[model samples]
Target: MTDPETFIRSTTRMLPVPGVPEIAVYTADEATALWEKTEEQLGQTGLPPPFWAFPWAGGQALARYILAHPQIVQGRTVLDLAAGSGLVAIAAAKAGAAAVWANDIDPFARTAIAVNAAANGVAVGLLPGDIVGTAGTWDVVLAGDISYERDMATRLTGWLESLARDGAEVLVGDPGRSYLARDRLELVASYDVPVPRALEDADSKRSSVWRFRAA
Candidate 1:
């Protein structure tokens, strides 16, 4: 068997995007088990828990949106919540956000964010902990693929609503998850994302991006 650490390090290297200038993203695919091993290695330092790495479809949609509409983030302070691989955060920085904060519960995720940011040649502030304690308001709050579970969806939606009430723009990207609250969300854009066979009910599934505004 391949050494898990080496496998993860090799698989997660910088990825280039076609036709997107100064834009690239890090993705965790089937080899995510290797990433888990990296997290174990990080445990020796007594740092925060490593954020779980997933397919990152939500982040991809958010990144595509930012690239298509650069004006949304230009000169604004942005927050990327549950930023798994820092794809949304990196996109915001590249789109000219004045500053970008990438928050996640996983320490390994924070490290990956740092590496991806540097690879993309943008600066991102890594917030390694729950989002509750993070201070300061932002012009925009971006989230991706966070509504898989009902309880988590409810709590996250509540928090996003709170941020919206405070005048912060809250946007979420999802692939039509069952737990998503359709009533409170608006369809900003949709894409036919390629869902891996392992993640989909069938061979592949197409996902959509839904944006939520405070109601």
Candidate 2:
């Protein structure tokens, strides 16, 4: 496999995140070209797309909300669950979170998060492996753009609800994804987040930050 750091650095460019310009991240200009390059480098077909290469609409909205309402994470331990590119985690750190942990199952995401956190001058702890069922003591738990798949959404909804019941402030950012359990969450904030046409059907998405309610 190609070195993830080297591939990212060579294939992507550091750019300010749209809708959340306070922080910048490595981003790919063209989705199809990057996807093809990634497959070629990894010598695999049908690989998952590089989610870390772009700030999704939901992540942009979440980061914007966290920066605007720093008190939510200020002096608290935070977990950016399934963090893509560590956008939300970096935002939490920038907003004064005592500690920030960015968890993702993807190895490339881990490398991207590390590179992004350093570029933004923030210290974000990168946690690898699956973290969904693990018990956590973080004061706030954040998830962004994770409801795109049905099975994943179902599993995470229950987990997030459990976290909320355990007294963690569980929050999710979504752009009305079909699988999102909206009935189980309370809306905290919403924003018109700019998104790339290559990844989304529209130029912008009406994304919302939601607080998961305890079951």
Candidate 3:
């Protein structure tokens, strides 16, 4: 039997993002270094800490949406919250947003975002730190695959509500995590994403993209 860590590492590299249909933006060199560092730090750790990781299906879905509906992002300042690999942020930039900011607490993610942004031929402002207390005004806020944990989902929903109340549009892409509050969420679009086993409890599952408005 293969070790879970080895399996995870190998599978992560092969994970594909639907709709993008392009190769992984980062080079093999960068990905190798990232995998080594992440495994060294998190291999034994029971639960992986929230970090700037990449190739998440939810993020890809949101990115696809932005690219397909460029009008939603056109001429707007967009915030990609918990931006791992800056996928959604890159899409926002490609979609002609006036400005794009990618925020994440993980330093590795920050570097990845910068590299990915350059790879995608777009400019993304990288913001480091927790977005909960960070204050900035934007026309749109993008969140992807954020509702994995219960507490995290609650916190994120609250933050999103606050931002929505302030007139910022908040869009979340998830695969129906248990923490998502159906009462307040509106289904925008859903997709049958190909997710890696390491990223999800099941081997693979189809996911959904949900959009919400300030109530």
lDDT string, candidate 2, 120-184, tens digits: 99999988999888898999999999999999999988888999999999989999999999889
Residue by residue across 1-215, what tens digits does model 3's lDDT show?
A: 44433433443443224446542444222344456656666554333443445467778778877887889899999999988777889889989999999998766567767867776778999888887845559999999888878888888888888888788888987777778777777888776665545556554556667777688
Best by lDDT: 2
C-alpha lDDT of all candidate models, in order: 0.70, 0.94, 0.73
Residues forming the 10-long window of minimal summed lDDT in candidate 1: 45-54
Model 3 bad stretches (over 4 Å): 1-16, 22-24, 27-36, 39-51, 201-204
TM-score order, best first, reads 2, 1, 3
For candidate 1, lDDT tens digit of each residue in 141-186?
9988888889888888878877877788888877777887778878
By lDDT: ranked, best first: 2, 3, 1
- Worst window of 10 by summed lDDT in candidate 2: 127-136
Among these predictions, the greatest TM-score belongs to 2
RMSD of each: 4.4, 0.9, 5.8
> Which residue pairs clash within candidate 1?
49-107, 50-106, 51-106
